[model samples]
Target: MTTAFSLAPLFRSSVGFDRFNDLFESAARNDSASGYPPYNVEKLAEDKYRIVIAVAGFQEQELDLQVEKGVLTVAGGKRDNGAQNQEKDNVTYLHQGIAERAFKLSFRLADHIEVRNAGLANGLLTIDLLRQIPEEAKAKRIPINGQQVLEREGS
Candidate 1:
């Protein structure tokens, strides 16, 4: 399929959300996966996250990491195991218990989010993400505005 999913409508329908709108729209085209491998996304901190993927047989050269617009894409392809070699390598199969396959995964990030790093160790691919809190999104005192405003400091 040319496209699988989209997050654009949710963003484009609102005002003052242009930056976020563009981000989500870009996510729709990041990486399209057919589900060979599996992965998980975990929140590490208030603004930090991690995506752990199970890339058991894929080597570093066979993999790619990219951030397009505001989306994160990870892809890998293994050396092809053709049907001719399958029968020759196996004696007999009672019930196939394991599956080894290549896969690609995609992640949509919030505005101002950045990938801190990525590494492969212990058969797992770890990608770290950090999102910077915008000044408008931070909490601050109201300054006691309106009728609630306090008297003059000098008084």
Candidate 2:
């Protein structure tokens, strides 16, 4: 059994949050597609983050990583090699539990977030991200000009 929920009420009184609401809806819809490759997201510091994915049985050449339009994409699949195919054809498995199928995963990044580095080690793919807020976008103190002028005029 499944229960459906509406996000309309959450954004009824908010502005400029349509994309945020869409993200929630998209995640809810993609819950069933989250299986296969397991992953972990960790915050290392105030502006640093790490994403680790288990990509066992996948080679470096078989995996791909890309970031575009505020989205990070990770994809993996076994390449077709003549020698590798011939070796696999002669082997038989009773259980065949290790999954080596093609998989793709996407993550929506917040504004100013950038992918810094990526590496594959010991069947794990690690991606580092950094968030850089622009100086103009950051909060700053504003001088009170009208208050001082009003005091001088009244004096």
- What would the TM-scores of all predictions be? 0.58, 0.78
Candidate 2 lDDT (Cα, 0 to 1): 0.78
Worst 10 residues of 2 by lDDT: 9-18
Segments of candidate 1 deviating more than 4 angstroms: 1-34, 79-100, 134-140, 146-155
**Can you write out model 1's per-residue Cα lDDT over 1-155, one digit (the tens) per residue?**
59766554333212222466455654444444434466666777777877788887667777899999766778786555588458647767787644545565666566677898999987788988887778998788856545845577898
What does candidate 2's lDDT look like per residue over 1-155, in tens digits? Answer: 99998764333221222477656666556555467698877778888888888999999999999988877889999999999889998999988977899998877777788899999999999999888989999999978765544445565
Worst 10 residues of 1 by lDDT: 9-18
Cα-based RMSD of the predictions, in order? 8.8, 6.3
TM-score of 1: 0.58
In each prediction, how many residue pairs overlap at the backbone (N, C-alpha, C within less than 3 A)? 0, 0
